[model samples]
Target chain A: MILKVENLNKSFGGILASRNLDLQVEEHEVHAIVGPNGGGKTTLMAQLSGLSKPDSGKILFKDRNITPLSTHKRVHIGLASSFQITSIIQSMTMLDNILLAVQSLQGHSYKFWAPVSGDAGMRETALNVLENVGLGRQADTVAGKSSHGEQRQLEIAMALALEPDLLLLDEPTSGMSKEESGEMVRLLKKMKGEKTILLIEHDLDAVFALADTTSVLVDGRILATGTAEQIRSNPKVQQAYLGEETA
Target chain B: MFKFLENLPARVYLAVTALLAVAPLLVTLGSQPFYLDLLTRILILAIAAVSLNLIIGFGGMISLGHAAFIGIGAYCVGIPAHYDIFNGFIHLGLAISCSAAFALITGAISLRTHGLYFIMITLAFAQMLYFTFVSLDEYGADDGLIIYQRSDFNGLLNLENPTTLYYTVLVTLLGLLYLMHRLVHARFGRVIIGCKHNEKRMQALGFDTYRYKLTCYVISGTICGIAGFFLGNFTNFISPEMMDWTHSGELIFMIVIGGTAGIFGPVVGTAFFLLLEEMLSGLTQYWQLIFGLVLILLVVFGKGGVHGLLVWADTRQTAQAQPENDS
Candidate 1:
């Protein structure tokens, strides 16, 4: 197993966002969590990525617990995540944004005399990451000027800059068109075997198509866990999904 | 050739700075005293404005108390000179240390607050310093003190000669500007700008953003310390008014009039401001009203100050002619 979560709990005031959740992810496998509205999928992903603190839980990465670490520390330690909303530095060039993400992973970004953009290695690595996410052509363009779909791709490119062991993508295709969603699915399919992906998505078709193992979450608890077919036929999932049949 | 000029903005600034250094030699090859004094004053203001740029333009930390650093630096020289402790190097060192220490303390407290609160806290601290200076009767108090002579350099460099002092101030300004340029493009600069652009994202990226901001604040103050040393020499006098709130406002106005983020903005703004003051005062006794009106007009109609206006006009012309090539 590459990641393990035991008895994870998060609450806001009196309402529980995540409750006694348990999960384990294997290396190099595409695992996904599917949930209905306000099902706490995002809360769990936030905790796993160190964006939110769990009230009481043990989060183990590579068999070492990392409940005490910050988001950037977790990123430095080979865990990276993208937001459900497209988050990027809009005023900077697409390449600069990737370069910043890569810089975070490298040694001592506080170096005074060395010019960051002038470094061949940093530039080459940034370009490579941009290319991997198919935004290489737009590297010189300001990120704010890019199309929405392109920005989403740039988000993935930024996540790739860390060379993370696991990529956590939340609603990667939230507002995307059907064709764009298909493109994202294809991109994930191409990356499936090479990286361990944990996708939190709302689009059932994309989730079923990309996820090898699907876990259904409803009301801050695990409703079921199995292959897509097993989840599709499960009675609780049927009720939670509002009897709206899906692939 | 094109690649070199791709960084044209920074290059032009360097060229301008180089010319400013040699201006006295070229214009007053006779080595006249009056022209030398004019050049020295310009260079001093340039140093102060440059420091202001580091915090306001780059770090996005608006400090309305910038002149307080100048006052701190000036008083460091003036107070020591008043007591007959007239070592130039010691005075400069004291100025740098005192200004930086004050900046660190004020910055640590103020940086925890954002926007208007930060501005008010910094202004309030400067006022406190101003009041303290006013109450110190032994050093001339409200009347201010005079430095009978410029700093003596232990028999190596004489600061009394107008031309030599002018050149020294110019060179120091140029060196400090170079340091600032290098700092802005460094890893520390990137983090500073990154924080300014998006504080939350930088925090999420695990940057101790407050430390970086406070560090910048101190660096800016230290640079202005050099400016203050020049200032006391320039006027041959110092007063509590050096730390006054209006002087602080003028420092910001210089940056605004020149264009905040532009490298050469401070030089242009300072020159324009000082020259206008000289010309306007000569024209009438109540020239402040005219100056105030002109400032209002400039702010209302000219969003980018003079340099920004020039750039905007140039880009607009080119954009109209070559729409496809422009963004």
Candidate 2:
């Protein structure tokens, strides 16, 4: 398994976020987690990404436990995530946004005297990542001024720049229009098998189209785990979740 | 309604800086030692503002203990002179190391708390240093210490001559400005600004933002310490007054008025503030009252600052050119 969560639990003051959650994601596969709102998809992803520590659990990635790590430590060890709300450095240029991520992956940015633009190799790599996201021409555009769809794509491009072995995508198409959503789906579909992706998405169409396996998370536990075909027809899953949404 | 100076082109900024570089000639022609001395103080203070701008303006770390660094630098000069060792090289080296060390220690602890909490902690530290300096009876305690001899550069540069000192300050200001400009465009600078804009995002992308902020803070202290060294040479005095919290607020005010975004905004802002204070003080003993009122008016009327006004004008001009496309 590329990722394994063993009996993980987390709670707030009075509410449980993740309750004895256990899951596994095989290498080079798209694992989609779908749940009703507040079902703790984000909390699980957070624990895995090290945004917050679990109350008690072991989160193993490639057989190495990473539950004790911090957010940046997880990133340094080939795990990267894109935020649901687009955590972008808004005041900076789009190229600058991606270039910062690129610079971080390359190592410490202690080169004070040399201009970032003067490094032809790093600049071209940043530009290529931007182009892949279809933001090639808007390289110099201020990130905040970019359209909502562009910002979402830029968010992923930053994660991609890390060259992570595993990518955590939290609602990659949130707040996007149908057309923009289609573009994002196509992008993710094209990127499948290139790396292991743990996708947390609400769009049922996207999950069905892209996921090799779908895990139904309800009340902080995996209700069912199966292929799209198996999960679609499973009476328990439909009665619990798919039935409510489709109803 | 176009005010020529208000709507001046970008090139005029360079011209104004150039004009200040030769202001010594104009002052000497007028045979005014007082104005020369005042302008020299402006240059030195401008250096501190520029250095402060590196962390506050670019790095977005609102440090309130900046004057503490200046005090540390002044002591580097004052303490050595008190011991009868007046070498320029030794003074400069001491200023850099001591202030940088203070920044490192204070910054490590202080950077852990951000925003208003960060401000208060830094202020508390600065006040601690101020009181500590106040208790040093060997350095004249609360009264302050006077330098009997200026830093000797082996007859290479005369710190004693007012004209030489004024020109010396101007050149240092320009040189430091160039170095800082180079810095803000560098990769390290990009990380600092990125962290300011969205620290969580920067960290998630794998940059150790804590170390970056601490480094910027240390560099700022080291640079401000250089300004302190100059301040000691100019005034021939060092005291706890130099490290007061109010003086740190004044440095912040200068940057705000000049627009911290541009490379020379802090310097330009320093010039505006000190010149206004000098003119107002000459006219009235109640200059501070008038100055406070004008500063309030400036903050309300000026959006972003003087440099921001220029940026706004540039954007408006572009919008005018592409009228159909934008709106």
User: TM per model?
Assistant: 0.88, 0.95
For TM-score, the strongest prediction is 2
Instruction: Give Cα-based local distance difference scores for all models.
Output: 0.84, 0.90
lDDT of 2 by residue, B268-310 (tens): 8898999999999999999999999989887789867778887
Tell me how much of the true interface, by contacts, candidate 2 captures: 0.82
Query: Per-residue error at B277 for model 1, in Å?
Result: 2.9
The residue-by-residue lDDT of candidate 1 on A1-247, one tens digit each, is 8999899899988888888898888899899999887889999998988878899989999999999987777877788888888878887899988887777777546676677778888899999888877888998999999988888888777787778898888899989999888988888898998899998988989988999888988888888988899998888889888376453
Candidate 1: where are CA atoms >4 Å away? A242-247, B1-19, B22-39, B137-141, B203-206, B313-327
Maximum-lDDT candidate:
2
Query: Please, what are the lDDT tens digits per residue for candidate 1 over residues B94-119?
Result: 99999999999989999999989889
